[model samples]
Target chain A: MRGPLSKRLFLWTLVWAVVLTLSAPTFVIIGASLTAGEMLQFPPEGLSFKWYRQLWQLDDFKHALTRTFYVSLICTLLSLPVGTLAAIAMVRYRFRFQGTLQVYLLLPFTIPLVVSGLSMMLFFGDIRVLGQLWPVGVGLCAINIPFMIWSVSASVNALDPELENAAANCGAPPVQAFLTVTVPAVMPGIITGALLMFILAFNEFLVSLFLTDSRTVTLPVQIYNSIRSVITPDLAAVSVVFILIAVVTIGLLDRLVGLEIFLRSK
Target chain B: MNRTLNRKPIAWTLLDAVEISASTVWPFRGRAAVARAFLLPAVLVVGLLLVGLGYIIEYSFHELDITTYRLKDEYSIINYHTVLERPVYLRVLGRTVLASLIVTFLTITLALPYAYVLVRTASAAMRKFLLFALFLPFFIGQVVRAYGWLIILGREGLINAAVTSLGLPTLDLIYTYPAVLFGLIQYMLPFAVLLLIPAIAAIGEDMELASEGLGAHWVATFRYVVLPLAKPGLVGASVVVFTLTMTDFAMPEILGGGTNDFIASAIYDSFFQISNPGLGAALSVILIAVGSLLVMGFFLAAGPGTLGFRSRV
Candidate 1:
């Protein structure tokens, strides 16, 4: 049942304030990007796509865009299978020190991002692969794989052990049974994990900042460099691009796995 | 068997071999060894970072030689001394801790009702809208959102323009301590809400209804029934928000205008600008220590799963 009118009013005001605070920045960026005037401003002097067109002209942004996709895709690809396997093991078996191992897996996520970035920088520098792109992708993969594992584990945990045992009793081999029965059951979790990992790698800033050189700069780092150098409508234009990606990702996630389940997995 | 052999001869032979191997290995089929085999890749990946953390701990003990870009032969606690003794470092640490406390409190306070509505509201459209508002900023990431604030609060930005048009003075809002905290709270609100959703969802509507039916005022019900039930969520959200804000690099770096640096910013300057890996490593080590201690303290108080790890049933 709904609350009394006064109580409902209070909640409505609080939620609206929160919703506005959460969403206002994207609106401001979108508004600023459409400015005909040169400087970045909200309540645009004249609505135009000049900044968006300007983004198209900039080679640095284009290169950073592709680099970001490349890194995020690589991270997702590497993390999905490994994370799914780990989740299967964690859910489908009972083993020694499993609890300790679970916490060990979460350590990469719990450690301060800056600390992980610094440690990675030092290690990469020592090994002399600091300037390359793949290490950055691998680093992203390592920290974010836990997300994939958790997502898939939720699905794995829901499956009944009896199903697999039944398949075995029917004379289907374990691998065949797993491929036929278990894979379809856990596909939702695998997709959610892959999408979440990709988005994370896309939005990752601190670690990429510490790890990336000019040759390996991702979109976020490139935007950071631009912010430090200048304030212009082009940044607002690119920010709109970021907002669009977020919207699309959210839409896809909601359609695929239902947003409530996605929230629960967190 | 004859029909299967006739259909695909080479494929059958391979399947037969695989089945034979599986049966032989099936003695204790769902065994620890099989689990280990599945876990090996993830373990190695986690190991890679653990080893890096080990290096960070080692690097914290040495001093950087400026001219040659080398660590000193003898290890010392001199870097830690620098972090402890320097007023600048101490100020940054103080500010970081204070800001994290404030941000955590504010984010959780705001997230609770928002999460409640998101979960409890009867309208499907409203739930979808709330989730959209939440995830949009979430997906936009911290860096871009911080930049959005620059447009809203910068000297010639939106708020200033509105004030000027209204014939009032535009206050200097950006590049201050408050601005950094404002951005941090915005960034952290989504995370807290996401974490708190399941916690709040676990508190079934029936419980609230039961409390209300017993003639408790809404406030009393919230105080006794809701808060008591959702204590773990509040604690978990608080811990996550505090640790994340404590090590936050983007908000202060973007909104602080270089004057208001957090510990993460200081670490960055030491490594990239000052060319002092030893100092950066030391700062990171301290950050790690404080974060772990706080999380450990929460675990002791709240038990395991405060960070939302669901143990097996």
Candidate 2:
């Protein structure tokens, strides 16, 4: 079933090279972040945590970091109920244009992030019905709601209808049966989905760029503007911090439900 | 399976009456009716955002009135004409397409063998390591990874340090097209593997054995058997990787320095730098059209190969 010995050996070498290449950036970033030199250098001249210390001293980074967490967390929480209900309707209902609706919600995926960001800017500018932060919140959901729907819908689809019907037959109301039966069954999916969207919103840059004015700057947008103004190891250190946070959370998520779950779109 | 519904509390009975009527009303007596309450919020939000998209599309045909920060009250294809007439835009478009094609090809090619190794390896530890290695980037944001490349490929970056250590000429890898392509391929490799793994996994071991038994060389087996079977994943990964690369903003911006630019960079400049939303809209419309065209090609090439839209059966 395997390839010939030589073929396998050739592939093994290729894979080794690829693994190194894929992982090299993270190591290099970590290494650069530890640089003691004045200029950003790799294979750092001397190891130091000065850059990491410098990040704490910077007001821009502190404020941006707080805003990033606040937005990502709030958006994830806000998106949960709406996304869960939508996923339920999508999975349970047999309706005209259901397929169209699914694609429409996922349209953000196909549309360039920057384009959507521009659209949101024009929109929010026109309609001040909601404050700036609220639109940014909804905009995050604009891109992320589909992910929640997909993740939760997978769990919803996996549930046995018999359980809900049984609860209903036992005189439990429909909402009560759903709360008792369906929600718990899908809790893991919901948890992972929230984590997934949190990471995405936290890391998102281009849309955040358009959404964030002077008043509401996000971490990634701040990092972006700062990088343009000057290149420094302190920025690298900040990036390392962000990556570690994401990696640690994702590590836990992978433990709870394998990354393979994402690979399987269904 | 009979249950005593009559014994339930009046509170529960009252709630059930409303729920039952909602699902069973004359105009709502279908499977879809049961879900009407749940779907209303998402519909409202999506409908609202679509209005934004409508605004952008409306603006693309007009000129920007920068003084007012509003589009001119006119409709024409002049913005598209401007994009076509501008040599820099044309050059960037060509480069973006070519770079995307090359990156997609290389990412998928490299990922195939690595994916096979990861999937087929008998040792659990190796698989775990491979999985860890693959998922590492998912944790790291694209901007961070691009910045990482800035460190690895900068004038005083890792490669330069190594070259100078050897008393050789230091290479300027950053601030160039190759550097952008290199970084993009690294970023996209994991995605390709993720898509390809499921496809390669779908090809049973027995089929490979059967091909080998038929006096076919392993290469021939791969060419005729594995490749064909994995086409769905290949096509899917290709469409995804190419579109992502084409629309990408970070790699080209971070690695391309101030001079080298992609379509996204052009779009960014038109809107943010020049205060020209009309042009920005035109460029975005073009990007979407081109991206959709390419995706259509992939779908035509590999029917049902695309994932995420519908149930398989």
List RMSD in Å for every model shown: 2.6, 3.9
True contacts kept of each: 0.59, 0.49
lDDT of 1 by residue, B52-74 (tens): 99998898899988789988979
Scoring only the A-chain of each prediction against the true A-chain gives TM-scores of 0.95, 0.90
Query: Using Cα atoms with residue i matched to residue i, what is each candidate's TM-score against the true structure?
Result: 0.94, 0.89
**How high is the CA lDDT of each candidate model?**
0.86, 0.80
Clash-forming residue pairs, model 1:
none
Q: What is residue B85's positional error in candidate 1, in angstroms?
A: 1.4
Docking class of 2: acceptable
lDDT for B21 (candidate 1): 87
Give a tens-digit lDDT track for model 2, residues A30-88: 88889899888655679899888888998877887888888888778877887888888
Candidate 2 residue A31 C-alpha distance from true site, Å? 1.3
Backbone collisions counted per model? 0, 0
Interface RMSD, candidate 2?
2.9
Question: Model 2, stretches more than 4 Å misplaced?
Answer: A1-3, A129-131, A156-173, A260-266, B1-29, B65-70, B304-306, B309-311
